[model samples]
Target: MTQTVPQTTAGADDIQEIVERILSAAALPPIVQAGHPALRQRAAEFDGQLSRDQLDRLIGIMRQVMHEAPGVGLAAPQLGIPLQLAVLEDQFDVDPEAAALRNRSPLEFLAILNPRYAPLGTGRASFYEGCLSLNGLQAVVARPESVLLEYLTPDGAAEQREFVGWQARIVQHETDHLNGVLYIDRAQLRSLSSNAEYAAHWAEAGISKAREGLGFDAGPAGISLD
Candidate 1:
């Protein structure tokens, strides 16, 4: 069952118009890039901000943009919509060795509203992460390996869930956007690499090799990272 947002006269129409504009194409649209004001501002909490039809339409467009970007997650701010909402999916056909190393697993599509998360423990992992908003570059970011997530479903029901491994990374990344934080803010600056460079060198070498070559320590030693 799909939940529809409550209609508010002028506000509903305004939000619907914005959503329609975003859905004008099925392919890529103008995703907000790094340094954009929208990406730097804290997003507002979503509370029936868009009418049901508009919300559903916006979600569909967002999914298309995310898939077209070939990204694991997307935040509303990336679309220049300052709302605490995001969609995530990680259905990539990962290599077996990489999967084992990162504990990577397939994640079904999910739409989360007003989401917040916190580290479940002190355990952390460092991995190269890229963003749709910051195309062509990736950096090593150390993040908690597990998180306790609290969010509202499209139906407006509250739910708390725990996510681990690569899935946890995706959750934290998306949630950080709502807080006006980017991965680069937490990344090891020396580990930044363009897509071409990463593919030509670091792709086969792994993070440890990347650390040695890039001359950046991820963090305190002995942290069990993949």
Candidate 2:
């Protein structure tokens, strides 16, 4: 389901109070849409602004919003916060078929700050990707099969790690938000489909079939789409 910020005119403090209430009680914040000014601009680095305890609280709030939105990942821009932060947790239990077909396994909750990534090798892959900011639609986006990511953990520790398969895709997708990029910007528009249409037409089809169906060429073995 889609959510929107309230339409009524209100002051900043009023909005802040509402957001606090939602966090303290039982409501999910409205996810900002694609054309929202915040989503288009590059996110600011999360310098040592908020205290450690404050960062911890923000993480908790973001995780809650991510789970409540029922999305695998969410970025700060999606909530109108222009900071380089994101949260992700790939829960595969509900759609085991899609998960297995997509080579996506369950992932523990992860929070990354000021993230950046580079392709690990020359290999590439394509897969249907969706964004909370661009709700209801999924598109085929070509991305590197493996990537080396550099980022600061929520606790401010620097980390450098390599990820392959679906994990790599997740990192690429989230980190792109730091630069104000969306999957759709790199996706095959002809392969676009609404979420329901995606389930109907390509959910069970292997990556090759979907690629062929959408007129895209598939890559070699390890970097295989599926």
Candidate 3:
């Protein structure tokens, strides 16, 4: 399935009520796990579905949840809201050596509303990815190395942007959440591992050992693990 989510419209008042109800239910909403119906349903797009204050609050809360989870990106479906909204940020906390190896750099915080993306080229890269909702498991998932993204800013201005390397992967991952897809759905089943197993058996070798031992091919792509 593609990450093409159809736009949806809801009265601002109605959306405000919904947001308020959900917020009141939890000061910090829990990340909905993999099997939740909300995670399985396609999210409704944002079309002025929030008043300025409500939108601000929602974005603030989303950012808090994302940061607290220590995740690079998070989508509304992960919060059980089923809305096409997401927040992404990365500090490139890794050492310069690792950052360069991953083609990673710092990213400012961004809230993407009703976002979509297209691969920039045929190039792809594979890496282990874990989700806040899935907790404690990681799997090798291959994704486009670069992507062109279209999204609405918090103020509803439409924008197009390009992201590369690790940032591109983050964009694809969160966007997939809005479309009711998880990384595991596109992962190499043989490469699945618990956090402990990954650290104990594959962390030092990067993905090369996992690929060779697990018998999955990452194909020719961006970052070389050889």
Q: TM-score of every model? A: 0.87, 0.80, 0.88
| lDDT (CA) per prediction | 0.80, 0.73, 0.81
lDDT, candidate 2, 40-106, per-residue tens: 6666677765557656766788888888777888887777766678887887574666666566777
- Candidate 3 C-alpha lDDT tens digits along 116-210: 89989899888888999999999888888999999999887999999999899899889888877788878887888999999888884258988
Count of clashes in candidate 2: 0
Task: In angstroms, give how far residue 161 of model 1 lies from its true place.
Answer: 1.0
- In angstroms, how far off is 101's CA in candidate 2? 4.9
- Comparing 1 with 2 on TM-score, the higher-scoring candidate is 1
Estimate candidate 1's alpha-carbon lDDT, on a 0 to 1 scale. Answer: 0.80
Candidate 1 Cα misplacement greater than 4 A, ranges: 1-17, 24-28, 220-226
